[model samples]
Target chain A: MTKLLEVKDVVAGYGDGPAILNGASIDVQPGKVHCIIGPNGAGKSTLLKAICGMLKVRQGSVMFKGQNLKGKRPDQVLREGICFVPQERALFPKMTVRENLRMGGFSMTDKATLEKRIDEIEERFPILRERRDQHAGTMSGGQQQTLAMARTMILRPEIVMLDEPSLGLAPKIVQEVFDIMKVMTEDGITVLLVEQNALMGLKHADWGVVLDLGRTLFEGPAKEVLTDPRIQELYLGGQKAA
Target chain B: MSDLIQILILGLALGGVYALMGAGLSLVFGVMRIVNLAHPSLIMLGAYVAYWAFRLYGIDPLIILPVAMVILAATGVILYKLVFEREARSAKYSEMTVLLTFAFAMVFEGALATAFTNTQRVTSPAYATDAIFIADIFIPLGQLYAGIVSLVLIAGLALWLKYTRFGYAIRATTQNREAAELLGVNVNFVGLVSFAIGLALAGAAGALVSFVFSFYPSKHWEWIAILMSLVVLGGMGSILGTVVAAYTLSVVAAYVGFFFGATWSTLTFFVALFVVLLVRPQGLFGEKPELA
Candidate 1:
């Protein structure tokens, strides 16, 4: 299968900082959930930022839909059908749920289609509909996460890159988040996420890409990566203590 | 009772202009985090624009208000591109922008000084010095007109922000810039347009200032302190807070000037600033910063 998105030997970091992503590469398949898991400082989040054009790529390239994303601004990358949800969820705290969603589809000039997509997204996330007028910050963590996900869907983006969606959520909400990722793939959107919970992330993802020392250490079927002895020893608490 | 009513009327009028001055500064700072030290210079420039138009073409300062706004807004665009755009890319934007803007302010002051000299100029149309009296209270026409115009502009701005798509982009940018950018909002464009809008508002206030107060190019030095007081007291980036603070403080200044002395009225700003800092450093409407 052709990769929907490809990050080839990308090197990137914050301003004037040492490279966090050193030649990190990934091949994301269309309509599949790909979870990137690694130890702390593994450059998982930096890889996502580099692909989405938030961080400037110092070397290599990010190709989405066969188009080189070099020198593109974050908004331009978003306009080109890639959306990013940062760890903070990036919602306007003072704005209402509906307003935040409107802002999410800001690139869309056609008001009718924008409103239509918003309506459809609200229908999909019924809680968003219920609290449509409420401030985003006032919502529960689960609802806010749902809103963040729903906001990304306003563009009907081909690729959605999420950074740590389940960092601070309850276990039930974490399951709901993974469930949402499944729904996202079923909706024809590619899901790329950096997850801290390796076991949960791999269990729910179709493909697991293991990253360490700013490079891809392993990539395989999620179950295969999960069962790998080396991965188990290094990441999954050392061969189950056997 | 009649004396107090007159003072209140005069104070509200002054407050209206103060709102216009504070709103632009609040917006630029809120959106760009650029403490545009050139703000008072822009205001002074606006007054000069109106003064020149009126003096040369015999047009009323109020009549040339829109033209002055457009001219100043264009200047804002130039300033943004020439000075701010490059500096914004730096890691030390907050610190660098302050010094850059202050330098720009001095450049503007020197230019105006060379062109117009240090002589005081006032744009006094026929009605500027006249007053409309109602039930033993008098309202100065110049202050009233300036106040009315400021209120109207403030209302227009509020509606635009609440209703329009571009306005929503501005608000989103103001709230969370990185989030706005990630969501496909062109934050650079937002910054450019907002900076222009801010200067345009200052121009409007300046046109009115030409009618109500006497000013030279160096008058901005004094005006900056006043504008700063209004912006800080209102809460750094809150437009509504700035407007409310403007009206409230102007009224207090009027009462103080009447009861105590004019010099004490000017001193009230610092006193209020000091107290607010001691009590609520975030100002009236600013969110309390979350402690990590």
Candidate 2:
């Protein structure tokens, strides 16, 4: 598998603060679901943020498709085929669903191409078509999550970085979100997901990286990591796989 | 009665200019959460620009509106780059902007004082005192023209915000900055452009004010207080609210002037503002204040 993105010992933090991501590193392969699971404050979200240019990287580098993404702004990162869906509800709440979707393609200057992409997206996510004029904030949690995912897809990005896609979601909605990830990987898009739900994340992902206190504890096939006694004890409350 | 109709027309005309002034102030506050105390001074600058354009070039202040807008927009861009840009991303942004813009206002006021020397000035055209009577209600030509121009400009701004791509970016940034950035918006660019547009609106309003009222550099302090009251009554960051509050308060002030005296008319703005603050601190249409 070809490496789509490579992070090398990246040190990052908020201003004048201790490092949240202390020398953390990971390689994400193309067309694969790479999940990073960790306990609170383990810097899973911060790692994703560092790669996407939301947080400033103090040291090391983020390489994507042979280009160094170290100092590029978030919009520049999006232009370079990477889209980040933040943990918070990232929709412009007052804007209509269609407006939110159009804004997702903000980098695209060609109106024809943008409209075509929206049409394609609407066909796949029929709910988006049905509620194109409705405000995104009024939608249910699952529906909003789906819309958020669809909004990023408008750019046809090669890599999607999701920060806790299932955070604060119901179990059924969580399952729906994971299914969307499956759909993304099947469509030849690489996904780098930061998930707090370790068990579900590991089960659905092809590769898993266990993060503990800003350092990688284990990196391997998701099934192997899931079955590992140490990960089972630390993350899964010692619950063995059925 | 004809008397009530005349007062209503006068109130609306005054309200139109206030709307133009308050809109820009409200927008800057909405997008960046910055209370730009320098806003009225910027309007004063626009007035001065219009004053000079008419005084030197023999151009109508009405025709000079676009020229004033461009100059003020450029000034806004430079001001954002020089002063506000660095502090924008800091934790102390809101607090810092108040002091920074207050200082900017003082410097601007001082510069105008140096240039124009605090003498009261008015742009009196050939038709400055011209009036048209309709059904025994007399409307001054300057106020009528300024009122029409203000409404048109305000409508144009509203349409731009609703229809254009840049408008969408501005609205998105206003709604959620991080979300806008993540969705490939150049938020810094949006900030620069929005500030420019806000000041441009101020410029347009200032040009109109030059024809309608006598002004000097120091007049901005009083104007700032009145503009702030309008914005506060309308709710910070709400364009529709600002326009509504402007008309409502102008009419109220007009009635007070008719009933009591012109001096008491000026006092009405502060009285209404205080009552609103005590009863509904968020203003008429404002949402509950978000914890910063």
Candidate 3:
């Protein structure tokens, strides 16, 4: 199958800083959850930033659906059907849930279509509908995370890149997040996830990309990488695969 | 009893204009993270616009308000493009903007001084000296009109922010700029338009100021301190906070002026501001500081 999105030998970093992603690359399959796992400072999140045009790409190219996205602005990238949800989940704190949903489809000019999409989102996440008038910042973590994921769906992007979706959630909430990942794929959206919970991430993903020292070390089927002795020893707290 | 009521009424009117000035400053800071030290100078310029239009074209200051707003909005575009935009890319943007705006304020003050001289001027329309007596509480028509316009404009802005698409983008960008960009909000455009709106608000307030108070080029030096106190008291970058704080402080100042003297009125502003800050350093509506 053709790759839905490809990042080839991309070098990127923050301003005046050494490249965090020296030459990281990944291939995302359509309608599959691809989790990137690595140690601290491994450029997992940086790779997502480079692809989504948040961070400047010094070299290499990001091709989505066979179009170059290297120099595109973040807004331009979203127009091309890619959305990124950073670790902070960047919700408008003072705005109501309904208002936040409206912001999600900001690029869409038609009010009817925007409201329709918001209705669809609210239907899928009933909690959002219940708290539609409540301020987003006041919502609990799990609810906010749900809203973040749901907000990305407002654009109906082909690919959604998420950085640390499970960072601070409880185990039950983390399970719910992975369940949402399942729902996303079932809805025909590809998910590119950077997760610190290596074992849990691989368990939920269809494929796994291992990043080390600002580069993609290797990638394989999720079960293969999960059970690999080397990966288990280095990242999964040294639990031998049964 | 009537004297206290009179002071309260006049204080509320002054508060309305203060809210307008504070809203402009807060919007600029909220959206672009620019303190806009040039804010009061822009207001002074707006007063001059009202002054000039009334003097030259025989236009009523109220009738010329929108024209002044447009001119000030254009001035905002030029200022942002020529000055603020370039400084935005720096690592020390916050600090740089403060200094840059301060310099811009000086330049504007000097330019106005050169063109119009340091002489005080007021826009005297037919109703400027008229007063409405309502059962022993006489209300100056000019101040009452200015207050009504200020409150109406503020309500319009509040509705715009709540109901409009661009307004949604602005609120989102104010909350999280990167996230807004990710969601396809043209943040640079939002920044430019918001900065323009901020100046337009200043112009509106200035037009009203001309009707009620005498102003000169250097008068902004005094106004700047007052405006800054209002913004700080309301919480930096909070429009609602600024409005509330403006009304509260203005009322306190009026009360001080009524009881003590006119000189104590100005001093009351800072005193009230400090008292509030002493209680809530983050500001009246500012979010509490988070641990790193």
lDDT of 2 by residue, B128-180 (tens): 78999997999888988888899999899889989889989998998899999
**Which residue pairs in candidate 3 collide?**
none
TM value for model 1: 0.97
The DockQ-derived docking category for candidate 3 is high
RMSD to native for every prediction?
A: 1.6, 1.5, 1.2
Q: Tell me each candidate's TM-score.
A: 0.97, 0.97, 0.98
Arrange candidates by TM-score, highest first: which order? 3, 1, 2
- Interface RMSD of every candidate? 0.6, 0.5, 0.7
Q: What lDDT tens digits, residue by residue, belong to model 1 across residues B69-143?
A: 999899999988887877666778978888988988899999999999989999989989999988799899989
Kindly report which residue pairs in candidate 2 clash with one another. Answer: none
| DockQ for candidate 1 | 0.91
TM-score of chain A of 1: 0.96
